[model samples]
Target chain A: MVANIRDKAAIVGVANTAFSKDSGVSELSLAVQAIKGACDDAGIHPREIDGFATFTLDTNDEIEVARALGCGDLTFWGRSHYGGGAATGSLHQAVMAVATGMAECVAVFRALNGRSGHRYSQGVSGELLTADAIHWGWYTPYGLLTPASWTAMITQRWMHRTGVTKEAMFEVARCTREYAVSNPNAFFHGQPLDRDTYFNARMIADPLQLFDCCQESDGGSAIIVTTPQRARDLKQPVVTVKGVAQASAQGQEQMTSFYRDEISDVSEHRIAAGDCYEMSGLRPSDIDAAVIYDAFTPNVLLQLEAWDFCKFGEAGDFVLDGNLRPDGRLPTNTHGGQLSEAYIHGVNGLVEATRLVRGQSVNQPGKQVDHALVTSGVGIPTGGAILGKLD
Target chain B: MTPEEQKAFEDRIYAYVGVKVCERTAAKDAVNPAMIRHWAEAMGDTNPAYTDETWAANSRRGKTIAPPAMMYAWNQEGFTVTRGRASDPQTDMVELFNEYGFTGVLGTNVTQEYFKEVSPGDTLYLEMEIDSISERKATARGIGYFFETLATFSDQNGEKVGTQRFRVLKFIPQEQPTAATGDDKLEVPTRIPSPRGHDNGWWWQAVDEGKLLIQRCKRCQVLRHPPRPMCGECQSLEWDSIESGMEGEVISYTCLRHPAIPGYPKDPVCAVIKLAEGTNLVANIVGCDYDDVFIGMKLKGRIEQVDEKTTLPQFYPA
Candidate 1:
């Protein structure tokens, strides 16, 4: 069982570099910039940081980022895997480190040149040498090469079983784009999406159009985790880490897990949600806002079901009923999510979730956000975290 | 034709149902390793039980056993398939269809179930009957009538070993469309090759020789795919292999359309196939239209040399 660490750690600062298609800088420079910005927000010098956590896919190394930031020797350093699936899992590592007194301050960061460098949308190309390449080899020869294609395999089956159509998928895209229209940091800002344009967009994979996919941006995001007592003296209002969890179910794969008994279900999300809720003593009804990963529009709907916000097969109706709007029931992705916002993998969603808990969102919901839920990517070993105002 | 004439034609075809296409015919040769090996190679199956004498002697089965899917090989007529065959109901029905101008024939479906295992020296006999005939229906190919045949096999001791059902469509050929005259001819791109590595090199080598081998733990008998060195179920370093039957159903599928990658069609139907041997692999659904693929659609796979350097398993509707 996961040890209860509710309110034990706090995120005192959250910062992100300008989201862009091209950064014109190295990933190490982005990392240093984001980390310096986060430390500045917390009213601390970069040299004060003593620990670090990040995703394994991050090109920037820990010692290099620490050296560039002039940080002291790191005591607690950790990294998680599966790309965006480990976005919050990296934070979970920091929370554990701070709560257990292993480190005084831990900075979790993700920096990438996803666009101008190695674009994931280009699909699998060149030779793959990793062990993960073995299973990927099974599909690449069949022309199932892209992340969108892997996701569509499950989305297609989900639609078949639930009788949902592209209309519901469009609602998810439209709702997130609505938030992006007002969020100045979002890549889709000021670019409103109409149903005509969405329907006219070329298909990336069956059931997934170009608009449904997330923007591959070159950007960086950082968060500072420390003891709740130490966070009370920070520059920003303390936002408590009420709960955090990472889980992988049986037969889990990196987005290609089709062998499970229910191919459409996100079992890892279910396990992680169960642990997160139990740890925080919160339920789906307690969450006022959510930053569910939206690498693709269909993921929002599937995650809505997996998180138990609504029962399975009802997310189509949930989104179509306008429940994601500011005055609506859930008010999801207020920062536009990865779909409309720049995709920093998923760490950008974490920054938005932190903003929601701090009551500083540009498109904050009308209701008070006492607790906000944020999740990493699905279709792999994934995780979720809950943030709330310090008691 | 008028409704009455259509009904008359359907009735005449339906009359052949329950007609014996073949009486009990003995196999020309007994089950042996040479034929088993040849069958395994053709089907791309590399189950050690079929050919590895030493491994089979030490394994649980204790001796060599033919793959259960090879039951039909024993009864084949080989080079003289047309000469030694007698006039049967199946031929008469085909002749009748040909006379009516429903001349194009296509094998659409086949399913086999095994009961008793057949090993070396087992002589098999076969009996077949026309199972059913459907009314003429329009299909993507043309207007066609479907007929099913069922065959049962038994060992020399007269115990049942297996049974097979085969379905074929006889149709009138559709008018061929004119070939494209555009100068923008689509160049066929070689498929992305499977990444052969230290762990999975043997599996790809088997595919080169037309075989699909599944890594199996020698101790716990657990099966692992993509050829890993360690079995997840049991922490065993010792392992062997079993050849897949290459029979499966589409558990899930997708059609990729955007950013048209090289080495593929405009839209290719890719599927996750749950093999009959209780494992799954991703492969292309070929030999059929993309729209025809569905969850739970039965399929049969073949290891084909798709490009200059790529040999992969491609599936067809079964």
Candidate 2:
């Protein structure tokens, strides 16, 4: 049976450090600050945070973070792999920990000095510890190094088959930038992306321009999760976890899964979407807003299609129709997403999902958000989760 | 180069797009059993469909048939391709790039989408068109231009059997020290060497000897690539290696361009090849124009020394 996680756990608090090109501090400092801020927002003491969950790529260790926060004897710790793909999976682990009584309170956090210390956009180099590098040997020697190039290879095929063009991709960037204009924390706040500016932007890879890529900012984001019964006493509105799941579809291989039958298909996203919906007893139509991962603009379109927000090959048209706008059908990335916001991996996205559910988003849509869908990265083992106000 | 000169070259090469390289070149011989048996023997393929006429005649095929990958082999120009054929748009394009300082050439990728199967006695014809050309850009392979071509194959009755897309790069070779003498040479960047662990070291060892080997399960007779200790079909540790025919067709490919990696030519065109042995291998295609490589295009592999310490399986047009 699917785990009956609906309404079992609640996000009582969400917080993030200022998004910037350089944090001027170690990733551990950012993690401790963000986690402490989250606990304060939840009306809990730092000592109350008994569990820690994060990404494998996170430089902060659970014990280090726990010690910094003065957290009591930790009962649960979890780390998910695959970068942004583990965003929701980290939360899924926290929810499982709280719901099963393995831990009373769990903090799911991600901290990165992406621009200052280790810029991810620069591309892969040096020795890799993961076995995925074994397969990457085939493409790396050929200059297929960066995440942008890996994404472009798959996006190019999708565009070829679906007839989607850069114009549609521009809509995703432009729309997300509009949301950022109102979000003071967004890196692109007060700056708007025009069509000509987007078109003239240098190509990172064909079909993906500078604006099509997300910001590599140094920041931290954390969310507090606990059983609904305990969360009822928290300071913030209860944003319950409706559904959450992680999936690694067949033929999965990090970002270089070119050997699959259909390179464009985000099978992991589709499977995770199906599982989340089945577990929550909710459908795409119920999602009033979404913050699909935007590592690249094309990924936004691919995930929109994978989650069935629109029919396959219709995501371009959907965005072109203005569905991603604040006043439109399904307002998305209200805090500008990774595109205009800061890239704190997917942690910040869950923070935005919580804001949408609480009707506290800076660019809150005119319509009430009953449920908001949030997903992690694509072209790798990935995941998603649904958040909504408790009934 | 002057901006005007760059514009002139761009216009000239871009003009080749949509131009036909070959209209209808017929295969030198009809599809026959002799070549099929030879290919099967070289591939170590015992599918019975291509070799056992009685078994094939009684099966769904109703008669002996050729492997779909054999489509390009039937029409290969053999030795004539080395001298460059007259009136060929691909050759003309390469000449135009070579006319500029971009003299180095590398076949990058090929992708073939098969629609039908060809049988013995069926005659084949080939047609090719210049599909697209890329602008001159900086790459790890030095400054270069990339071009692509689409090749379509059809049977005698005019039924389309397959189409292939090939990409090639024409570039100026980057300068580097030729002498392999310094201790820092080991630290200097080179092609990300293939990981040869306990399970697959023997395979890399064979490639060093100029052979491509596929692991065969001793019990089930299943062939697998990227060798492992156990067979997936049947749980068995007993396995042996079969020297691959090396001749194969491009199944899929890509030309990587951004964040140019070290120890690699600019815009390395990578491809997955379906070996004649009925297994797949990932190898670089070189010594031909990138656009001239395409799906279903026949290629022959040779283990070549790429750097001081590395010898890898690289492919060239058959």
Best by TM-score: 1
lDDT per residue, candidate 1, A1-391, as tens digits?
A: 7779999999987899998998999999988898888898889988889999999889888999989999888899999999899889999999999999999899999999999888888677556756677778777888899999999999988988888788888988988999999999899999989999999998888778899899899999999999989999989989999899999998788998877767789999999999999999999999999999999999999999999999999999998899888988998999998999899988888888999988989899989999999999979899999999888
Candidate 1 lDDT score at position A37? 87
> How much of the true A–B contact set does each candidate keep?
0.78, 0.30
Model 2, residue B11: C-alpha shift (Å): 34
The segments of candidate 2 whose C-alpha lies over 4 angstroms from its true place after superposition are: A131-133, B1-188, B241-253, B272-281, B285-302, B315-318
Candidate 1 lDDT (Cα, whole model)? Answer: 0.87
Model 1: runs farther than 4 Å from truth?
B1-189, B217-223, B230-238
Q: What do the candidate models score in CA lDDT, each in turn? A: 0.87, 0.85
Best by DockQ: 1
lDDT of 1 at B188: 36
Positional deviation of A41 in candidate 2, in angstroms? 2.2
Q: What TM-scores do the predictions have?
A: 0.72, 0.71
